[model samples]
Every structure is written in C-alpha cells, then in structure tokens.
Target: LLLSVPDSTTGTISVTGLNGASNPSFLGMFTTIAGFEPAGANFNNHYPMQDNVSDFHLYDIGEFFPIQPVADYNAETGIILPPNPNLSGQLKEYQIEFDGFEQVHVDVFGLVTSQNGPNIRTA
Candidate 1:
C-alpha cells in the first residue's frame, strides 16, 4: 500500500517499498510536467532514473516530490492508473490491480533557507 501518488514526475525521486529492506527500486522518471506510462508491466527498465540532486531528497516514505519548492508552485496534477481497461479483460501485462490501487501521491514541500532574509516557497 502506497501513501502518496503523483500524476507526473518529480524530476528525480527516491523509490523504496513501504517497509523492510526492500524498496520500490526507482521505476521511472518523468521529464515533463505531464506524461503517461507506456503500456507494460516490466518496470524493471521502465522507471525513471536520475542522479541525486545536490543534497535534495526525492522519495519520502514512498511518495515522490521535489527537493525544493518555489512560492506558489504546485504539483496538484495527479493521475490514477485504473485496474484493467475493462471488466472481462484481465490485464496482466499492465499490472493494473483489482483491489485498492496502492499508489504514491506526489507533492511539493517548503524548506527553511540558510539566508537570514525571507525565502520563497511552494508545493
């Protein structure tokens, strides 16, 4: 079961299972703000990969988010992948679940800056 599910990519994010030593190995990365996953279940080489940002964190718990946020910026765009295109059809290749669509929601968070003056923030 995932806690957060984002509709688009977070540029770069860390992926790990909810608990235990096993984590959801980074499946794929979204380069654009809006996009979709090509038809398939083999996320082995399908997920996006990226070099960790300068001290920036990608995945928190199991959700994806940017390391930093700008004032007013929003990642509200979210798309939920449905289970199977239709009823009678069993979509095994896509891994569309029949029960709870466990997913990771994406969002932006604020950060305290080092600058003495005020800093901008967004989510």
Candidate 2:
C-alpha cells in the first residue's frame, strides 16, 4: 500500500510513500526505500529517504548511491531495476523497493502432503 502526504512547505506537490509506514511489516513487505516522481515532461531528481532499513539503495540520473539515513533494520536482499528516465509517464507512483517473497506451508506429518505458495496481490 502506498501512503502519501502533500509537502508541508509545498502544498501543491504531494509525495508518495514519503512518511512511510509506522509498522514496516504492516504492508507484508518492509518498505526499505520509497520515492516519488513528479508529474512533468522532463525527468526530475527525487530523494527516497531510508526508513526502516539502512543501506538504502537509490538510483538517480544514471547513477546508484547507497546511503544510511535510518537506523539499521537490514534487508536480506536488494531490489534492482534498469534506469528509466520517463518512469512510465509519471502518475505520482511510489517507487517501492521491496523483496517480493512469501512463506510456504507444508504438512510433513500427514501421508497426504500439502504445499502452499506465496499469495499475490496488486497495489
């Protein structure tokens, strides 16, 4: 889930996934990094502050910069993607960096074995 609030200083400009979720696990995946892309023609630079996890990975203007803005809540894996300046026509979507995985349940004791896979959900 994406949560956004208008900039206190710039009311017209709202940021998505800025404040971040208080409970990192609330959305199932811990929001290691979150950023916003403004609506416009040119590609602008935005900041994705480190929230629950440190070592936040960031991509800006064809370069990658990793920083630690928050206390350590280390992520097991890092999310990656090729750089896109257009960002799929800037609708103010939150660039969410998350490790997408789910738990599996198995009935080891029963003769009839049952297996379960991860649940899939859309934003």
Best candidate (score: lDDT): 1
Tens-digit per-residue lDDT, 1-97, candidate 1:
2123333324333444333434433333433322222233222432222122111123223332332322232357554344432322211111112
Give TM per candidate. 0.19, 0.14
* Model 1 weakest lDDT span, ten residues long: 89-98
Which portions of model 1 miss their true places by more than 4 Å?
Answer: 1-12, 33-36, 40-104, 107-123
* Candidate 2 residue 63 C-alpha distance from true site, Å: 14
- Per-residue lDDT for 41-88 in model 2, tens only? 222222322343222222222111232232222356554444454333
Model 1 RMSD, rounded to 1 decimal: 19.7
Q: Any runs in candidate 2 off by more than 4 Å, and if so which?
A: 1-53, 61-91, 100-123
TM-score of 1: 0.19
RMSD for each of the candidates: 19.7, 20.6
